[model samples]
Target chain A: MTPMTLADAANLHTFVDALRFIGDHPGFLAQKALEQLELSGAALGIAIAVALPLGVVLGHFHRGSGVAIGASIVGRALPSLVLIAAFLTLLGIGFVNNMVALAVLGSGPILTNSYDGVDRVDNEIAESARGMGMTGWQIVRRIELPLAIPLLFTGIRIAAVTIVATAPIAAIAGGGGLGDVIVNQASYRLSGVLGASLCVMALSALVFVALAGIQIGVTPRGLRGTTVVHDHSRKEQQ
Target chain B: MQSHWGDTLQPALVQHIELTAIAVVLGFAIAFPLALLAHRYRKLEHPIGVFSALLYTIPSLALFQLLIPFTGLTWTTVEVALVAYTLVILFPNIVAGLHSAPDEVLEAARGMGLTRMQTLTQVELPLAIPAIVGGLRVAVVSTVAIATIAAFLLPDGLGYPIVLALKEPTPFKTEIYSAGALAISFALLCDLALVALRRALAPWAARGLA
Candidate 1:
């Protein structure tokens, strides 16, 4: 199907129609949103569970070992499409498969940020904690983990936004998401595409805000302002 | 269809590469200037950075569809989203890399009577290679990945085979796997090449004693 023209996209009727369509079938759009959210949440949850610990442990050891860097780099660089497509071939089509693919794609940022967050903890802080008879676990639990909250959630936030944004592609695997609306241009046409895009973007924005709130909530209020906004996470988005 | 697998897979790979090149090269071209502008004007960084960051968050699918009205399912449409996706990474890297140049080193260049532009070109830029290249590596890899999805916009990409296979009554597993492998392989190849490029561009980075 050919794409919509500028006129169609700009026509006041388009926005009105799209909004009406969304209003008319709130259930369908809501279901799509929930499905997208579920897949995104599952994908990011798996990624954080796996990559977060690995990153935190590697960071706690203060090891800049090649494994840490190599893993994050490769993880960040691997595209979601490749993972999704590859999994589709191997696993056919399933919710579990889509989650794994997204986990693979999202793991890099989590790993990288977690590692960086822990690795960059002030030596004085760790040493002071150690000097006070803190065990390795104690130091990690008290000093490092608290300090790393900003970065840890930053990683999760990046993963969350990315997963939410990319979950639509799950449609190709027979997984439900807004991606179906975008692809089925025949039925939806311009408004469907535009409306779906709006929904997906809204989902992403909601995910980001919700995660950011968590990041801030966990962070010590004083340190909150200083937790650098990791805007460079664009690499993870596609 | 039993014959000439070369004609098919080869072009798909090349087209992916061409798409990557167009997107990255042009992305860098636009990003570098913007980076410089942001660097020169500190106030610009916040707005420009925020804008790019917001743009960055817009999913590739939405962004591509968002442009269909203007670009209309053409290669240009794909490239627009691809390039926009790149800017968020590229701009920050260029500016940060430039800013990351050690003040003393920059002062030393200035002390040697190099003009501002001369200092930037001769000393700062070389010093900035690692970060800039780091950004480039990410940009290239992600662009390659994003371009796979671009097949939904325009044909003749690795994504084409995957999309096509899905449409088949029984989607051929090998076909999907092979295309996926090639796309992943192409991204890795670009990444490795850029690693080598960074090393070649700034040999001092390896030694770390700079």
Candidate 2:
């Protein structure tokens, strides 16, 4: 008991015990990671699906970027924990509620980035495409979407980072992940909590690094510099 | 009015705001100078940015849990973590905002015989208000959200109701509603007020939201 207590302390012993915990409960950590990935990946996928086209169209015509901007402001203000709990009372503690919260949160970045990306495309290119008798959709698909791809990916990266960081909180609503190990300190024991937290942190880091690699890989070499700077603005929302 | 366990709403809302305001003000105070230094000495950017990012990357729960051994579930633990989260956002925004002033505008100020410090205070800072205000809004909103988790540590602030309702058999409906709604409201109000404040202070940059 004493050694387990020491191991749970979130210190060097916790780190050592974290390794041991993972080794001992490989199945448990793997399942938790799976839950986390599923939620965030689902949330990110839905957010991009909804926000990307909306942002592109709005940005193309320059009509309602305000929606993206305002949503982000409101979204940043709503704490994920509270939102999840609120949804729990309303929707019952389950996957749907947590998924809804993450999607709402993640939509902000994707929409805003898509809007900014499409709006910033070189108008001259679009005009030339227009002069060549291309219609709005064709011009968009051909010129603007290609140009906006990097920014779109930046948005996804931002949303993915936010979702990964936030997904652990889903434990509160029984939308279980590493948060079970984090919040149920008594049940999992402190070493378990600490070890699970290390797992959550590692999961988030892995998501961030992997997505960043994807962002870089997708972006054209010439556009890479702009993409890097573009990422800093995305951080402002977080 | 009592809603189980003799808890009221006013104090929770007030404390949440107070806690959030203090952390943001203190965070801004510390981050500003660091931003200035980082901006002035280009060499400091990566290291400072990395340090802030490292602090920011610590998961909120892990951070609180890590501090329990030393701080013993105190406000100090909450404040330290809250303040640390703001640095990564604030430092970069301040630097970016300060640099937002056009190079020509800065050179003209220098040509006006304005000392470097005076130009920074007088010319550059005013120009930088938009970015600074943007950063402040993000920090305040995020802090409000994070502050709710403080209930687990001290049973204080809006988080108290939130934590209580979620944990105990109290009719959690009101508690969850009040805490969540108030937090969202606080964030929106603070953000809107900052937008107005930015507009009032820096009218020049009002050209299409700067």
Scored by lDDT, the top model is 1
- Model 2, A6-117: lDDT tens digits are 4356466655775798899999899988988898888888888898889999989967856867767777788877877887787777798888878888998888888888
TM-score of each: 0.90, 0.90
Q: Compared with the true structure, what per-residue lDDT tens digits does model 2 show for residues B183-203? A: 888888888898898889877
Model 1, B1-210: lDDT tens digits are: 334258667778889889989999999999999888887888898898888877877888888887776557788999989998888889998999888878888888888999999988888788889989989988988888888888777777888877877778767767677777788788888888888887898877753211
Model 2: residues with Cα > 4 Å off, grouped in runs: A1-19, A227-238, B1-6, B168-171, B207-210
For this target, which candidate reaches the highest DockQ against the unseen true structure? 1
What is the C-alpha lDDT profile of model 1 across A1-238, one tens digit per residue? Answer: 8887667656656667677777777788888989888888888888989999899999899676466677766775566776787787677777988988988888888888888888777776788989999999998888888888888788888888888888987787777888889888898888887788888888787777787788778887768789633332342342
TM-score of chain B of each: 0.92, 0.91
Interface RMSD, one decimal, each candidate: 3.4, 3.4
What lDDT score goes with residue A93 in model 2? 71
What is the DockQ score, from 0 to 1, of model 1? Answer: 0.47
Q: Is the docking of candidate 2 incorrect, acceptable, medium or high quality?
A: acceptable
